[model samples]
Target chain A: MDRNFPQELLETIQKADRAGAQAVIDAWAVGRPFHRVIPELLSPTLETFGRLWASGKDGVSLAEGYVAAKVAEDVLSRVLLDASGDGTPRPSSKGPVLVGNVEDDFHPLGRKMVAAFLRADGWEVHDLGVDVGPAQFVDRAEETGARVIGASAMMFTTAKNVAKLREEIDRRGLGNRVQLAVGGAVFKLRPELVAAFGGDGTAASALEASALFARLARRASEARGEVPA
Target chain B: MNSLERVLAALQNRSSDRPALLLNAGLYGARLTGAALKDHYRDPEVFAEGQIAVREAFQPDLLVSPFALAGLGAAFGSRLSESSRRPPNVAAFAADSAEAALRLPLPDVDSHPQVGYLRDSIRILAKRYAGEVPVIGLLASPLDLPPLIIGLEAWFDALLFQPETARALLDHLTPFFVALGRAMLHDGATALALTANLANRSILPAPVVERLGRPSLEQALAEIPGPVILHHGGCPLLPHLADFKGLPNTVGYVVDAGEDLAAARAALGPGPLLLGNLPGPTLGDLSPEDIGALCDRALSRRAADLQFILATCGADIPLDTPADRLEAIADRVHRAGRVEA
Candidate 1:
């Protein structure tokens, strides 16, 4: 991965320079596949933007994340469209994935990043956004037929809410069909929390999250004696 | 030595009977002292009575007000709602943008009812303790205040995009803090505990904290007459240790329990007192014996460091935390102090 493009994209996003950030992505994506562009270029760029914003560098804001997401979305949509060549009969064989911040936790940048990465990785993603309750996650998964649900909790206090979602899934007997995946600063600090809170797995970062969910989804399918699509 | 003497000795690097324990026994005060948490925060009389009762029962070195962090924002005209289980929180934010935030008026501390309630409670506790136990008043840090007035997303956005506006907002809020600090000191608060949750690496990076959060904090600390303890929730204070070192009159740094004490001690060096890393959030799950064991371990790890104090990393111990656990901590520290003495 050339660090130059990601570094430049991070600066542009931090400045809330959406046009410049988009241009950078567009320029880089020329004659390249999104699978290469996303994991290598766009995801790393967003991660840098997140780190810089977290660093509290001058002119960095939560809004920068919104801008970065927009740029990633623009590049992703164009690349996917180019690959499909007219968008007439493209079908997603990958099952839908549900992602959100646990109830009472409003920090959603990581979850948004995961949603974007999952989309780029050829999975259907339903982002429930921030402060999503346990019931909402289960209901959305049921509605969307999502095979995996990803919950991000930023604090130890709200991270406890993830357990509630776990219990609800168990009670619904959807534990086998729907796997619960958790991440965030708390999980990074305490990795054991993923299993302790009844989650099937945990990811350390956005890219890892998308990969973790793919593996979990495949394992679920294998358990049901079906070939992973 | 009494609790106050023990803490004072530790702060001055003088020999003490034992390590001073500043357990955040504030939230547990209501339940242990027979005052409802709601009444304890809403009524000055109940607040003082509850604190005194808890002090008598647990006998920790400091008495902290259990008032929610929303008081300052509420005083500045943000809507606050009181609850029975926990402290009041901002029901509504006052501003959404940097320009609007800068224009928000500075609240007169004297005119705010909640401020008066807290001040009265401080005076009552101070007079009751009468130089024995220090009554520390809780004030939201300048960095922590903006998110309360303007919603957190907006405040953080301003921090990333509009640096000057964020600083201006911090500057605007600093006087209110200075006034609040002065009033608390005047009313007998022996020290001021500023909750700077945003200064942690989990939220803001060190450089941004150094640039924006540190200056406003310095301004507020300069006006504060007594010792100022900055309590930041989250661990690995290594990043912000330098910024913490630069602040004036900061006698102690209260970091969360997950931090490596030895690393923090080495990073902080010998000047400032290292007050905590006791797992606060897990207090509800641990028995008194368990808590005592944890405290004993922490004390043993820093046994050679005289400036160490056993305290919680977070401000309020959970409301449901057992009184016995708090007592166990205090008793363990007392035994350690006596044995050392």
Candidate 2:
């Protein structure tokens, strides 16, 4: 399979032309497995756009990057439905995970990106939505029996409150049962913040987040003395 | 020469004893007073008192207004989250859609309590500091304000796909920018810090910004009584400096923390003062010596450029940023600047 998407599709997304991007995805995705299509095609496109957003290069805008992400998300959703009998996701090899922005952090862009990447990577993500409090995160994780909790905060002030997730998990005596994974622009800017804020781990980008979650998920399983999925 | 003079000298690209130092200590001022962060934000009197404490302690060249977006957002019916632990953030967008936002009324800066809260803070700080220091008034640029009014995603969709709808919102916000900014200047703010996030190249391509962002900024800056300082507003600035050049009343820019200060100064040319590249909220995590070293690096990067001010970049500095961290910065630059020992 060709690793590179058509340059036309790249240009289309850069123009924020949603229909053109969708059409490209429809064509390129033909005869491709959802797993291979996601890991090989979509993730690379996202990483490219993510670089554009990070570098602030001429002619590229975040609007264009947002278009690419939305297209990636759309293809994933459609693939899931086609694979499942009733839109219920086909059984995943991995455990479910929870993701949300910490309480008072209305910045949902980063968290939403993380959700899409996780979903694409085969994790059933229970997105708690923005402005989610610490209790809500732990409670949802407990109810879902999810082992890894990903919390996002864009600002340092909000990032400080990410610790509350750790505090809540410990208070419930789920310290060994549940693991905390944190991220956002702030964490990337200050790599030390992940450890300082009590996150068990962090990833640099949405694509990297899936790998980080996998590692933490393994640790949680081992602590619980369960066989790895 | 005092703080105000040092800032003025930097604005004019004139040589001074050293570069002007602006802490951009957004709400760390409130933290200095030991007031509940929420109370410090809520009560104008508390906010004023806090800035005074910040001033007494650090003697920064500029006093920035509080997160004016939260208060000014109320003009469009936006509400604030109630947080005792940290300063409150906007709990809800004023309008969920761009069309809904356009229908909202433009604020009367003289009477709107939310607008008045910001104006009063600047007034108090400006009045007290008087000729001693410059108070930078915060005014969200027309392109940037819509995201605060309507949510970011909705605004982005409107801006990219529905050009007319976004234009209408920009048209509506431009007047508010002018009015609030003029009022701040009237109240004694030496300059208006035009926080232009949407103007950043990363957010909108240069042509889009030229078509959508520049005209509103051109008009607003021309309308405001004081000179404007173009801030990165949480995004990088150096790449797009050309789009902002030659606007009326624009005196400088606040470089993004991740950007190279020397490059920003070079791109901006010798015309406008460049202030920034320090991460404001991360100051609390660093030692005084580290902060001083970063300050020294910023200074050396400029390498004798008189048109510069050392400042913390991004939307704000953390509230718990230790006083000693700030003092360390002041000891680095403020002590070396113009006439006073």
Candidate 3:
């Protein structure tokens, strides 16, 4: 679908009017499917919000991006509930995905957005929050039988920790069983860092995280000679 | 000229024999001075000892306190943690919401233990240097304090959703910074450095910085004494350069490595000292010879500017930076000074 984000909704979000923004999204969703709204309207709005936020332009604040993401998350949860009422199996019944910020990094908004997107895409997501160590990630993955682990680092200093986490994951012999994905502002700044840190995959934004996780899952299944579920 | 004279001359926009080097030499100096980072941060005496060793090693123009933002946040009841390698940081935020953050008790700058420790550290450093070298007291700016007081994400949220609450929190915290600046000055600090890590395009949009950050900083700057330097490692200060220049007491701007130095110089004019543009990330990776070459390049680029000071953009020198590489940069600057003489 050719999705044009409503400028009015974007303005409402920028104004910090969460209720008005939600009302606008709800109105738009009256005739549209939740899938269409998420990928087309919501995702594009978030991308635009980020761009404007970073542009240091008028009427944009880091807080507006936070508010927009929160509103989108609420809408996503509601959409998922509504979709589940139609007597269809939830899309995320495939396997659990664990997401978190790497050690020594307190920035978790990226990881939280990735988790929300994955949950919206019908995957069971386990969010480990920010400043998470390698052992915690591995321990949670083992307990939940997570098929994919997503790690994020916001700075070059903390991005170095992702490499350590990757080593710990390999040392534990979970390298093949669990796909390790890494991203954040640092990843975008240094594109080669994904491979440098021994990550299975990387995505530029939370919007692309679901697809990246799916591709990694497919590759993991192929490596195991198992039919793609 | 002595190290102090060289730095003051550069700041005065006069022709010093060479560019003044304001090396951070804080964290790396701790390791070199035989003071563990953990010990240096915990005890004022160890911090003073580390600062003295760093001054002896580099003989740089400025002597910044070994401690950074840990004391300010801790004074306000935020939890702090120390590690062997890294500088201490807020272990946990004091509050989650703007109301709760504003409700945090204002620290008694005179008697607060952390503030007292910082004051003692400054006093010892000043006495040891005996006014030969200038000591800088560091304080986080209003915009930067939110993240330390509350969490980063929540603070950003407050900036967007509840700006009034955010402003009130800053208003409440502004006195503490002013008091800290006054006390440090009384304790013999020659100047104060305010670190505004959040006032950048990467963290907040420019309008928000103008609306929220500028006023709080102006209020604090109005009360603090002159010769205050503004430090923000986030590049692209071009947008907020005007805001900084408008501050009454600001005498210099520290441009991070990736920022446009020419743009900053153009905006700031020749009056305010422009220090830095050195990349901190490559400090550990580059060889001593490479570091000297880098210094030569930076000096040659701004040969005509009389107000430039060679310095690192970041507050803390990277832990792994080789002592020889740092010495090389200082050696290059000193050699340049000798040639000019």
- TM-score per candidate: 0.83, 0.90, 0.90
> Per-prediction interface RMSD?
5.3, 2.0, 3.4
DockQ of 2: 0.54
- What tier of docking accuracy does candidate 2 attain? medium
Per residue, candidate 1 scores C-alpha lDDT tens digits across B1-341 of 78788778878887887787776766667777677766787788887787887777867788886547777777777877565555665657777676797887887788778788888888889998986998898888778888678766677667765788888888788888888888998999988888776665445544567687777777778877788887874545555677677587788888667577888888888878888877775676678878888888888898878788888765466666776777788788878843342
lDDT of 3 at A142: 88
Please state every model's RMSD to the true fold in angstroms.
Answer: 4.6, 3.3, 3.3
DockQ for the candidates, in order: 0.19, 0.54, 0.38
- Stretch of 10 with least lDDT, candidate 2 chain B: B332-341
lDDT (10s digit) by residue, model 2, range B165-259: 98888877888888778788899989888777786667775556778778867877788777888888877677778888788888888878858
Go through the candidates in order and give each one's C-alpha lDDT: 0.75, 0.78, 0.75
Q: Quote the lDDT for B22 in model 1.
A: 79
lDDT of 3 by residue, B143-198 (tens): 77777777777787777667888888888888877877888888988888777766
Q: Name the better of 1 and 3 by DockQ.
A: 3
Please give the lDDT score for candidate 3.
0.75
Which prediction has more favorable lDDT, 2 or 3? Answer: 2
**Which one is best on DockQ?**
2
